[model samples]
Target: MAAKTDRSDININRSMPPGKIIPELVYDDLDQAVVWLCQAFGFKERLHFRNHRCQLVLGEASFIAKANPTLTESSNNNRLQPQPNQMDHSVLVRIEDVDQHFEQAVKSGASVISPPKDYPYGERQYSVEDIGGHIWTFSQSIADVDLSEWSGVLSDNPEDAF
Candidate 1:
């Protein structure tokens, strides 16, 4: 493999370049989901697609939301039909302050899954479940620690260990 120094080698236009991965989520009620996400998670609405879809942004992160298709289609994907207060996957959002975000989220109607706590990995974070049953974790880095302190071995070859 060759080293990539800039977009010039990839032929990506600066104005229309690709961004970090944006997650796609499904909800039983997209309108309610949009409102709840904005109010609870502090996401800003970027675009509204009819009444069934929406684009939301928070800082450098963004995600797309669509109405659930469980009623329209007969598929047994449990993930598509998220039960109330339960979710298989969670979104981890890097925020400026975990304690403040936790309080704001609770005041905005987000159910607390976990309170703000510090971790050995050098992050202070908190978790909450949205009205749509999606888990959102807000994290803030509190310190820069050596990996060995946390049982992570440093190897010359990055892929040599897991």
Candidate 2:
């Protein structure tokens, strides 16, 4: 029998990974990508799915790393590719120390896109490109600034706000 979560009525499967939204990132080399991501970003491996995919977690956030299928395997199947010259999307992770995370990523040979910078919105963040070209932004909250202070509008209903 499936269990239920207090946060919501959704059924919780202990055998499956957790996270409201888990990004399944495609990489040319699954093993290398997993190692690099763990070493560079402090992600811990939560589950391994043979040689094709794996689940990784950083704090409360989790994402899947999948091997990009070959042309033969992609035939008549959904085609997934690694990030090309132009990125389709980027992953953002909130951590305790953006500076420490940035330094670790740099030491692990991650390509830096932007160094740590403080924003008026009360976050210190840094961006980097992984070995497979995926962009990841690490952020740390430095303050609890109101949304209006950063030109963000608050929802009329307090319940609508995250």
Each model's lDDT: 0.78, 0.87
Q: For model 2, give the RMSD to the true fold.
A: 2.0
lDDT, candidate 1, equals 0.78
List residue ranges in candidate 2 displaced over 4 A.
Answer: 71-78
Candidate that would win on lDDT: 2
Tens-digit lDDT track of model 2 for 81-150: 7554678889999999999999999999999999999999999999999998888999999999989899
Q: How close is candidate 1 to the true structure, as a TM-score?
A: 0.78
Ten residues in sequence with the least summed lDDT for candidate 1: 10-19
Any idea what lDDT model 2 has?
0.87
Q: Report per-prediction Cα RMSD to one decimal.
A: 4.9, 2.0
lDDT of 1 by residue, 1-162 (tens): 444435444444322213356677888888988988888788898878676668888887778877786643554555574676656788888989788778889998888989999999899999988887888889999999889889977779888543
Clashes (candidate 1):
0
Return the lDDT, model 2, position 13.
82
